[model samples]
Target: MTNPTALQLIARSNRLGADSRNTNYAGGNTSAKGSETDPVTGEPVELLWVKGSGGDLGTLTESGLAVLRLDRVRALPEVYPGVEREDEMVAAFDYCLHGKGGAAPSIDTAMHALVDAAHVDHLHPDSGIAFATAADGEQLTKDAFGGRVVWVPWRRPGFQLGLDIAAVKRDNPGAIGAILGGHGITAWGDTSEEAEANSLWIIETAAAHLAEHGHPEPFGSVIDGYEALPEDARRAKAAALAPVLRGLASTDHPVVGHFTDSDVVLDFVARAEHPRLAELGTSCPDHFLRTKVKPLVLDLPANASAEDSIARLRELHEAYRADYTAYYERGAAAARARGEEPPAMRGADPAIVLIPGVGMFSYGADKQTARVAGEFYVNAINVMRGAEAVSSYAPIDEAEKFRIEYWALEEAKLQRRPARKPLATRVALVTGAASGIGLATAKRLAAEGACVVIADLDLERAAAAAAEIGSSDVAVGVQANVTDEAAVQAAVDAALLAFGGLDLVVNNAGLSLSKSLLETTVADWDLQHNVMAKGSFLVSKAAAKVMIDQGLGGDIVYISSKNSVFAGPNNIAYSATKADQAHQVRLLAAELGEHGIKVNGINPDGVVRGSGIFAGGWGAKRAAVYGVPEEKLGEYYAQRTLLKREVLPENVANAVFVLCASDLDHTTGLHIPVDAGVAAAFLR
Candidate 1:
């Protein structure tokens, strides 16, 4: 039988979590306490069902809950060693499982169990946290809610913190909740409905109080030279700066990136107090965990040229890295003085970067994380605004933040994460990826854990192809005509903004014309060369600049043709363009070798199945030239090959993967033929 209490709890959680005003993503936990029939004793026992570790409330299910015997959890204080050893209490939770234990208990399990209520909600609402992190939080709590809510001073979350909250609740019988200083709020009631209502009341009252009494502009007047640039100009600047910032953030490891120019972010960055508030950092543990202690703020004006901004950013990054290292050392030294061993330094790169006019860029191990990090920073911005209006923004002390950031429990959680995929951190861009070989290559790279950009002339088809691959985190689509230099550069910029800088590029956009020298027009020749030859050069040239800026080696692959080497009749224009692409592989490999960039080519003959070129009448034209029907052309070509196998788009895609795979790390300037066995096309 289903537990109605548990169902109601989930419903309440989803409702509250759906609104970012209520809580940020995975930033809160909810629990219901009720009697359940114990399978072993066949008797009723009090049980606690709460959202488990690392689960988002909006998407939570039964499996995402941690089910434990309420009595056992409440009894934890009997054996609680002390605040210094409170982390040990988390492991003790395993012994209190009601059955198979639905999910791993979060560190907040004690907070849920110790509170004397049938239902409890602990959330990081922006309004609630505003008062909680204000300099005069205690007085603000008394002024806003009077006797309805109590104020608890800042204490790192642990069993001791849970005990402190329980004590406060017991002392204030009429109170509905308590606002934790330098954190968020905790609300409880006799039923799920009551608890949810109480939570909302606190959030709403805080917001209303600020609206009625607080100043109109909390961030201060807009500063000179910091006002937002026009929409088009700001976006162009963002696109230009994204790659350089990504490179800096990825100094320790490859990370995915996200960009935002929302009004909240733009307005905050343009304010006079932006630098001071950002330096104080976020207050809530959830906020700092994702956003880091603080961000790297770019000091350039809104109208600064991209070239000057780039140079200044490089200098800023070096200083940011040094400061981050010093912070780690200071924290480590403090921990050692207390006779405790601190966790190893994680990384010295800033997770978030702030630009006055361009907005914010956040980095993380993946796109979702990066996006969520940005979301959290927005929440922080809102908190700052509200706090400043009511009183003054006050975050936790630096040492406390360091302790929480490097806690042993947090380190253990990180170690338990699943291993990364083979190409987990790599990003790739594939041109003409709406169909055929280009699409196949994009999909394959995505499957191997690479973030991919699907570039094609048609935006609709390209977006559809990107959707077919996976979520926006894994793939994105862009409209780009390879012949246009600006469009090609924009596509590369999209890659930089979407998933950091590029590590691989596949130039597969081409059209075929099977016409003899006498039948071919000058326009036909120009079109072929423009798309197949000049297109590859343009995309490569633009990508190379970014790769060089990143200081990370990359791979460039040209999808040439077997006709480049073979003397096929009636294919004059295509064959000439293909030959040009073949030479590009050699030329780029030689030029880019010193930078550790590898250039290669794939030669495929008559890929009839899923071939965009063939579907565009190239197959019929070739069949007429060979004196055969269009449907028989594939079989006819296969019969001539030594392996007697028809070539396919997937075959060419596989060859691209092979050339770029780590196994071929030392190989360069190579072309692999995917023609089954074309003796004439075989490299000498």
Candidate 2:
């Protein structure tokens, strides 16, 4: 009969995956076994279904489970006493799967299969790892669980680990779970309920033991738990530190940086004892694979100036990288001593960075990955706090760490992720990105893997829009009134600081006025000119300076309206300013061409849906202009176009994206239209 426990296992596994307090994205694995008849032969067979490699447990489905024939998997000669070839061991694993659809079984499957339980869970709970990595962890677990759990020293994941765990299980037949020193924990039972409960029991017992001994919070505030400081003295100091650190921590290619000063991070980094203790290494083996061991910690001085801070971050970055090279040598030597040829290691760049006076930072190729690194490090800090409170904190020895750091399997997990999108390493800034074409463009660029800065006058709305983009690392919302030089400069700084440099600048901020010339006062004309014409110039000017400094040919796109080219009756002020803006693009293209910069203009017509202008009564005003009801404005405009189609914000955004396409290296000083075949507005 097929397993009746699959539902319960799925439920419990998802619960564990969903809670960051338990594990972060794809950090743990789960499995369940059952007996069933083979589909092809109708013969009774035992099956093992475990979480697939690279599959997210939080949203795991039956399709994500790798179905394997249990008898075949357990009998593989790769696990036999005489077999030691990791390649052969890997090949053996691939040979046992029952189907070809799901992802490859997780590297932990062999260990899970050997547990001799219907249900098994392997979790990287921070609380459990605290006791596991404690200086006296071996005995601490023993004392807390009173032999209810077994202790297994760290070993690289493979057939050998399965054998070691099996041996431990054999020795302690009464124990429900075991701790893998320097790694995570494994628990098993007849059902997922029993297995999860026992796992929670082990975690709680270890966590409680530490608390009972002395529940001490790590040092965060300047003055105990009462009134104290949060990181550096001023908010501006903390704000200024992000970009400088981002520039330093980034690698040769591209890695986005994320900063967090949440209370947890501050407490962990602000501790007087952290500098020495933090260097000990990762909370678990999975961490060693994801974030590497240790982090690049920056020491912020009292009342540091901007120049001093920048210089300090740069100096510290150099030292951090140089120290990594030396550490890599020691690790490589240790690996060679094990009689195994060490793989050529990459530069020892710490994935996590802790700043004593601010908070913490994590780097990854993309935003989601950076957040994962941040979450894992935060978990580590909390666990380390608990472990140190109980006794001295300790992690696995250097020899074992060397094995994990160089593990072919652990490295494969990173390399196996999907290929990056075309705009993978680029950073883009979209002004007026709170809604309409700007918002659409921001989403498009972010989806293409570019770090996006959403600049708008309304920061609260812009931030909400950015959050909807769903990757905080790539999407940042900054408040900017483009007419104000300082606000414009600050927005530019936010982009450059967060992403190391800026590449694309979209000058899309604008306002529309439809008053007749006779009724239009000097005030209305100035308001339209100041925002549409002057704002574009100001934002563009600031952006070019940064691009010139980087010496990287970048793109600057101006989103001028269709009125720029076609004279609409009541749009004199808007059209006149737009014409000036469109001419500005050609002028910029001429001037910036020498610096390898490309400048272009996009004129969007009839984009009503999701357009901020239309939402602000522009639709009703335009409908009145056309002598039609307000609700039919979209239809009215669509019918007026040759293509008989509605021009949506996405249509405008697509035109902007085309203008920004990488292949158009020589195609600057152009105006692309998106108005469903508005022949008059078309670029000739």
Candidate 3:
């Protein structure tokens, strides 16, 4: 077989880059194993030539490469910091200096180093990255690549990243390369041209497959509207970021050095939004182990000094630590149950690099690793935006993520076991807990050993319901208008402060307004939306914040209605909101699944008795309309089901309990019916 020339290799790289562009962003990076020297000589050698940072593969020139002694590069992490810096970068350049001195190395050098193949190439092909960034990235990878490729969970690139890659290669001896979910692809070949060709092939395959499936362009850029900051503003931002970065990292293992005094860096930080800047960390889960998942936003008041910015950053850092500690604890319990050793404090501090004008640095083990992490984050933001375009981007509750992050094995173990007490020692917040399904679910969860927080608009009734449960696991009732963000957030804060964390949230607070589609008034529609749809969204958001911080995968159950699917007469408002509830569950399930959260909805048909709606004039009116005695209404509703049995509040509660407990580990984005088989045909 004829060896490919440089031009051929460049053409293949360009094709891969073109394939990547359809997904958004420039095509990803690529690298190849170059000629190696004799080890006996003890001289400089070139083992790999990896893509340099900020260079698109399609347009890459000979200079857009960085040759490093692969074995030496891998060994650098073991050396002390001082020695590694002086010895590695300079020694690696002795054999070949492909780029300018200041050029950043490709973020995926670690992965390439571990492959140890003759050639390696990695890229964030548009379709692949978009698919990888999805909640079901692993599953999607399986569907696309089948069982041939090695799939690595999202991890920050660096020493650990290399280790993970090595582990994969060791485990899967014949694996061609590894796929990093929520990030991109890694391919290896016997030669540089083969590596480049493999990458192009992978991209072409993914793009073609996704195109056939009608993949939407990953939500296009939304950052164009942000106005650039002024020079004065930029200076102030840099000055402010310097101290904050120092303070946050001063006591930690590594500290910032490169951009601390750079005006260019400061200008970039000042121009960036605080929230956006703080969020620039890696989007992948493994990145968190290297760089704590979130960054601290240092927002100084107008005319505030550097001291103020430092203080603010310190406060935020402390807050992040406190939240992480709490999350670790919650996740620890799950870990213990799974027979896994709890995470030791590895001195892994938050990845809060100072970006100066762009905001702050999203520090990882190194610049390349940080860049990859940032890419993951950017992908997540894009996914959120895209999902928002389709519908609301509701993520799974934080508690669920925490649980997954900490004790996914435990969750699995718990699932394997028979149902234990409904929610042993778990803390739950149940909205609309005063009546109907909410009250019954609260009682059931409390019976199962959960400390239930009953929140309802009716304080008196919520308290009464709490009293009825009478479990030591029950807490004082909290009156809350679920639609009110502050009120819901307060409830979440109280639960976290009081119980130290939360395990479940049942968003059952909702109202039904029956009206024909044409007759539905705007006020009536808004009222139903506010109470049912908006309330669930707000409460879930508040609960998820705590759960994610706690690192415990918590369950969130939205109380949808059968009308979500089978819309009925004079129930336009209720039906629409119910449909929204179902969609909300799916969105949350997708967004929060990686965090180990499982979101599901319950659609109870004709829940009889216990509901306030059935205890008043509305019940009598409904009974008369259906030609049944008011007292017989419950039975009549129950008989409407295929099972010819009434759907009681307890039945709804049981379904809710199943979700809140560990019984449904592999389940999410699902709708369980407690309506006695009314919707039997739709059953999976």
Top candidate, metric lDDT: 1
Give stretches of model 2 more than 4 Å off: 1-3, 77-84, 214-235, 329-348, 425-427, 451-503, 541-554, 565-568, 583-598, 606-610, 614-648, 665-684
Off by over 4 Å in 1: none
lDDT of 2 by residue, 1-684 (tens): 335655666778898788776666787788888877777898888878888888777888777787788888888744555434654565566778885625587778888787777888888888788877888888888888877898888776777787778778778889898888777888888877898888888777777787788446543234232221443353345556655555455554456666666787766665666777778877587676667778877666435565676677778778888877777788788767767676677655667877655566787777677767887888777678877877777877766777777766666765887897877767799999999889999988887778899999999998998898975677889999998999998898777556646779999888777777897889989998899799999999988886675556689999987888887777778889999899999999999988888999988786788888787877777788889998888999899789999888788777767777677768989888777778888766
Which prediction has the highest TM-score against the true structure? 1
**TM-score for each of the candidates:** 0.97, 0.87, 0.41
Better of 1 and 3 by TM-score: 1
Per-residue CA lDDT of model 1 for 1-684, tens digit only, reads 559999999999999999898999999899999998888899999999999999998888899999999889988899999987888999999999888889899998888899999999999999999999999999999999999999999999878888998999999999999999988999999999999999999999999998987989999999999998998888888878877788889999888789889999999999988989999999899999999999998887788899998899889889988988898899999999988899989898999999888889999988888989999999999999999998999999999999989988898989988898777777899999999999999988888888999999999999999999999989999999999999999899888878767889999998998899999999999999999899999999999888887777889999999999999999899999999999999999999999989999999988897888899999999999999999999998999899999988888888888888898989889989999899998899
The TM-score obtained by model 3 is: 0.41
Give the Cα error of residue 373 in candidate 3, in Å.
Answer: 40
Candidate numbers sorted by TM-score from highest down: 1, 2, 3
Q: Give residue 75's lDDT in candidate 3 (0 to 100).
A: 65
Give the per-residue Cα lDDT of candidate 3 at 666. 84
Task: Give the candidates in order of lDDT, highest first.
Answer: 1, 2, 3
Which pairs of residues collide in candidate 2?
243-497
The ten-residue window of minimal lDDT in model 3 covers 255-264
